[model samples]
Target: MEYLPNIIFAVALIVGIGFFARNVKKLSRNIKLGKDVDVSDNKSQRWKNMAKIALGQTKMVVRPIAGIMHVIVYVGFIIINIEVLEIILDGLLGTHRLFSPLGPVYNFLIGSFEILALLVIVAVVVFWIRRNIIRIQRFIKPEMKGWPKTDGNMILYIEFVLMLLFLTMNATDFQLQRIGAEHYVQAGSFPVSQFIVPLFDGLSESSLIFVERTAWWLHILGILAFLNYLYYSKHLHILLAFPNTYYGKIKPQGQFNNLESVTKEVKLMMDPDADPYAAPVEDDAAEPEKFGASDVMDLNWVQLLNAYTCTECGRCTSECPANQTGKKLSPRKIMMDTRDRLEEVGKIMDANKGEFVPDGKQLLGDYISHEELWACTTCNACVEACPVSIDPLSIIVEMRRYLVMEQSAAPTELNNMMSNIENNGAPWPYNQMDRLNWVNE
Candidate 1:
């Protein structure tokens, strides 16, 4: 009967971690549904990018207020969770303060954790106020309505509760240790939670133990729950940011990827001695059977990774010139739409036993619109603004490629320019000989 708590803890841990693993597997499968591309070049640069952007969060501080608050919450939450290791050990072995043997080191670690926990609570409160009360324009955008808004607020609440539970557990433990309660050892300092100790001053030893155990169990369970919740939330970036930044676009932003087949055709057209009807050589690097991306499957795996890694922070949209000028092209919405469609496709595949059934729906014209796609000036501001290296512009360009190449749906102005370029070798409706006439005029 004494081991029942340990058994229960073991069961809960297994279930929580097992569920999280399953979700991760599903996320991996969904991301892999997209086409593959070679991101093998620049290993050194990629590592540096991951380290600088994801680990160091260099881009996040572009706006000081939110970035500083985020760093506080981020650092504090991660550091405080180190105590979870101790909790897990204690739960499994039926020991209290399992690391108490470390003496002063343990006390110092606990003191630091207490301080961080308090900081995390304060940061979370500030985040809540910014989102709910202050109503930051980026946070209040159309894409952030409904579940997105609620999810954002809910995450803050979870962090708030978790920190409170940590302090409560620590305070009760401190009180119990002062009274020399059975199984409570003299260990660890609680700089922040020390103030919380007075609340338990009058409680009996048994009651104090009950409160501490309850808080401890709830805090650990909450962490587990938060872990699993990440799959459903935009917070998947918390895990995927490292890899996303590593595989992020390294080429110059203005340089678009040209179609291999189109490039070959253009080269042949310029060759004087090349046979017009010669059979093409079979090579490994071939253009896709279809031009451009009309759906999630048409995108490269990295772009899909970008979609999943979106923080929904709206920095991209806030920076986009098109969005700034009141166009329908919100870069944040572009990523959100891609992710939503990808999720829809994943669910469809899941329902049909691992094969995607034709759902008569696609990312283009359905989730995202023609107006939004056309509004983009290909300026790449969204790319620059993404803190985690998500390039929403890539998705926009791919969809635009599909619209132009597959459907011949390029705007009339673009069509006319393409025609002029083909016939006159310029984006003007003038003969080559007459092109220089503009100088005289």
Candidate 2:
């Protein structure tokens, strides 16, 4: 009973600290990125989004095998907490098995957890083999240079160890019961554990006790450490996935941010003593401000936050036709570049740097090349493929609007296409009058 209370206190303290640290780090990162998320203002909408993406696993289901594996893993993660609860209760009450009173119900839960644990282990092992042995090019590309592969390998190893520990602990517990050291078997039909019990029959009672205790601590502590590690690594998905899914945009995926109206106030600021709604003077003497993203600070906080939330799953890159056809455009690189730019600008902004906009060069000109931007077909393939629902197309279109409308520096082919749209109501070169000629023929 004394040991029970101590164990409960220790586990609670570790869990509390781990949760606090994870949230603090997430909050600090959001602040640094200048994220001003206010989903609270639209509670119903937010809840709907959460229901669709989080509970539904809408984005993950795009790949069936991966999706099924993820579903099992997700459900397992939630249900496995029951084991944690039982551990705490057993430690607190000085009981060999906390659920002894529940009889069949307890057995059912234990059996379910045992099965889920085994399934999760199998699923994760397959995922690891697919990523490493199958050598999915997207997963191991050179661009992931900054990412730590060891982190992924470590997480896989930890999960594997936890699963093994779970099976071993239950098997030993069942063996102890058969030998009459303990009368409680919370789960009666765990086939794996039962099959393994006969082999351990020769072991002494002291050895059995030591093995059970060791497995219990390993399983519990491994889970706790894994929880903490999730927050710091790419596995942050384990925590952030729910919130990220909830806050995802429900608007048309192809829709770009609208430009602010060029009203009287904007005109007055751009040119004094002129009709505010009128276009600004095109005189050579007038200093023309460059359009599009001039630097990282000019980007909206949501776009900046998108960088941190990216799962680096490489789905975007894999689906990019431009990348497939050997163009310089890598959607993955675009995301990484955005993250880097945000970090650099964040540092400068923190130091009270002069301005958000840069002079002489545009974002497309320097950070992401114009060729790369133009190569995008606006097909929404990248958007559709992203596991996190990142809308790269919107960003591309916004920058394109600035290039075409403000700088008038679009490609000659695109310029011709726009002219055709104005002259013929379509991007075809045929004159409107010529439509009658084709009909007559």
Candidate 3:
């Protein structure tokens, strides 16, 4: 029964990791539901983008106040969690302070972890205040009303609690070491937690050990739970940001993707020698091609990746011209709607055993309204504002494509412009021969 604790630790570890892996598989499947596109060009540029944006966080620093605080939380949390390796090793082997053999190096590492843990706690508190108390306009947007608000606060609460548990565990360990308790070693420094050690005074060695064990168990378990919770939270960016930035759009921002079929027809029209009614080859007689995306499946895989990678920080929306002008088009909401619809489709597929069944719902006119879509001016401001390189504008343009080509339901002004362009070779109601009349007037 001495090894029973190790066995239970192993089981918990396996279960946590197992559930996380299952969620990853589901995420990948949903992303792959979109049509494939080649992103293999510019290998060096892609790597540079991933390194600069994802690893270096260059874009995040564009806003100074929030950016610095975010960096502190991000860096401190990551560095503090380095001690999790030590925790896992100790738990598995039933050894206390297994790395203490490293002498002063272990002490230095512990001291650093303690400092970072404190900093992380401070940063988390600031973040909570920014969301709830300060009531940032971006945070209080309509799309952030329900679950999004709750998820944001819940994450902050989790981080705050996890950091507290870390310090509590260290404080109890410090006390146990002072008492020369069994299995406790006089190793590692605790700069911040030393203050916490005073609270453990007058307690028996047995009580100290119990407190230490409880804090230790809770800390590791909480980390595992946070890891698994990423599947449901916008914090999925924690894992996907690297890949999303790597495969992000590399072309010029204003340059749009043209439909190959439409380009082909236009080219033929300009070819003077080409027969207008040429007999079609067997391959050319195939069914007509789809014009644009009416649903998530019609979008490219990279766009789908963009949806899953959205941090929902609302930087995109905050920078959007239309949104700033009180338009219904919130760029953040576009990405959120896409992700929600994709998840809904994925659940339907799961219920049907791997095949997607039509649920009489689609991304357009359902989760995302035409009013919101038409409000966009295609200014690319949102694309530029995304720290992780998410391109919400691409999805908007594609849906607009579906509206114009598939349904011929473009706004009246747009239809009139197209009509004038087709008849007069210009976007005005005048004959091509009378183009010089403008100068005469």
lDDT of each: 0.92, 0.70, 0.92
- Clash totals, every prediction: 0, 1, 0
Sorted by TM-score, highest first, which candidate order results? 3, 1, 2
Itemize residue pairs with steric clashes in candidate 1: none
Worst 10 residues of 3 by lDDT: 73-82
Worst 10 residues of 1 by lDDT: 279-288
At residue 270, candidate 2 shows an lDDT of: 67
Compared with the true structure, the alpha-carbon lDDT of candidate 3 equals: 0.92
lDDT of 3 at 324: 93
Clashing pairs in 2: 4-91
* Model 2: per-residue Cα lDDT over 117-228, one tens digit each: 8898998898789777997778776566655466666677888889889888888888777677754453455756667677678998778877888888778767767766
TM-scores, each model vs. reference: 0.95, 0.75, 0.96
